[model samples]
Target: MTRAVAVELRGVSCEYRTRTGRVLAVEKLSMQASDREFVALLGPSGCGKSTLLKMVAGLVPATAGEVLVYGRPVVRPLESLGMVFQSPVLLRWRTVINNVLFPAEATGRRDAAMRERAMALLRLVGLTGFEDKYPHELSGGMAQRVSLARALLLEPTLLLMDEPFGALDALTREEMGIELLRIWQEQPKTILFVTHSISESVLLADRVIVMTPRPGRVAAEITIDLPRPRSGRMRVLPRFGELVSVLQDEMGIAT
Candidate 1:
């Protein structure tokens, strides 16, 4: 039996009309993310990576083409999808668990099961002990983990992440990447991650969808065959370097 397509973009195009002129951000982009697969949108600045993400999240409408989730047209945000931004965006006053509970409350899911699910998600993100800590008390990486936990609380079938760890320090970013993989392994959800880092894409994604510069289109989609449970050591592997080099060339960046 064939698996279902979790998300599909068909000839999807977006154009913005400005005072100067119409600016095309993405054009004729077609892609599908399989159920439970972790896919990454890898590209340079102005590549419209975030634009595609916004379209999926229903935050912005596509100028042309269709965006579908679970075989249905997505004209607006759906409950089955959750989103995490580059910033944690947690309320400064809310504790970690409260922040996780915020979404449930907003969606009117504040029930016993919802509370249990929120606490479970916090533990899944490895923040079991820091549930009561405020965002100010948490480090950048820790804060992002809370954000991830919050997104998971919605029990979304699809998770959309836009450069979710772009602001962390090098070491912290690397550690968070590992933690993300662990979360993915435990509870498989279809993930669409947008990232500027080639290595991060290769490390975390089952497939890397490389987009072109402005007016972004699908330049290439490469499958990452590296073994799972990937870590820093995978960075030094020969095949890993080759994949990075290929992605670099695709991005028109020097090796």
Candidate 2:
């Protein structure tokens, strides 16, 4: 069965007007994110991946083009969209559970139902025992997990993640990736993840959308045909190497 398209960018371009001149971040970029699909935007630092993400989140306005979420034009931040940034950005004073409940409280969703939902999300992210822990008391990875739980508290149909695991050590990053996949499996959401790690993109995305530098555009899109529930072991598979090589070539890296 064909899944519905959850989000789409039609002729999307982002231009910034500065004293110097107009700086183009993205140009005529178009893509579709299917329902329940995990898509990764992979490219170099100046590729406007984060710009595109901000646009999708309605935090930034598009210069020219249209952004649609679930067939509706996305003019501003919608309640059904959740975002996780590179930093955990948790409130230092709030406990883990309180931080998780921030979204609901901010959106006037603070009811019995919302509180129940927040607690459930904390449990989902393995923070059940750490509900009262402060952000400084937790490890880096644990803090990020709290961020993840907070993002999911809204049960948004669309989730935007900007290199959420980039700050962790390699081993911790790998573990978090696995944990993310597990969470995704349980509560499937259309995810647009931005990352510089080619391997991380290949591991998590159903479709890897590569972008060019500066005035970013779609450079290439390599779909991962590897089986679902991907583990670290899958990285050693021949097909995995093939996909990695292909992405590297697209990124102008010699295989």
lDDT of 2 at 137: 100
Q: TM-score of predicted model 1? A: 0.96
Whole-model alpha-carbon lDDT for candidate 2: 0.93
TM-scores across all candidates?
0.96, 0.97
Q: Write the per-residue lDDT of candidate 1 for residues 165-185, one digit (tens) a residue.
A: 999998989888898899888
lDDT tens digits, residues 1-255, model 2?
899999899999999888999899999999999999999999999789999999999999999999998898888998798899898999999999899999888878888988888888887877788989899999999999999999999889999999999999999999999989999999999999999999999999999999999899999999999999899999999999999999999999976
Candidate 2 wrongly placed segments (more than 4 Å): 18-20
Q: Report the poorest 10 consecutive residues by lDDT, candidate 2.
A: 118-127
lDDT of 2 at 63: 90
Model 1 residue 86 lDDT score: 97
Q: In TM-score terms, which candidate is top?
A: 2
- Residue clash pairs of candidate 2: none
Question: Lowest lDDT 10-mer window, candidate 1?
Answer: 107-116
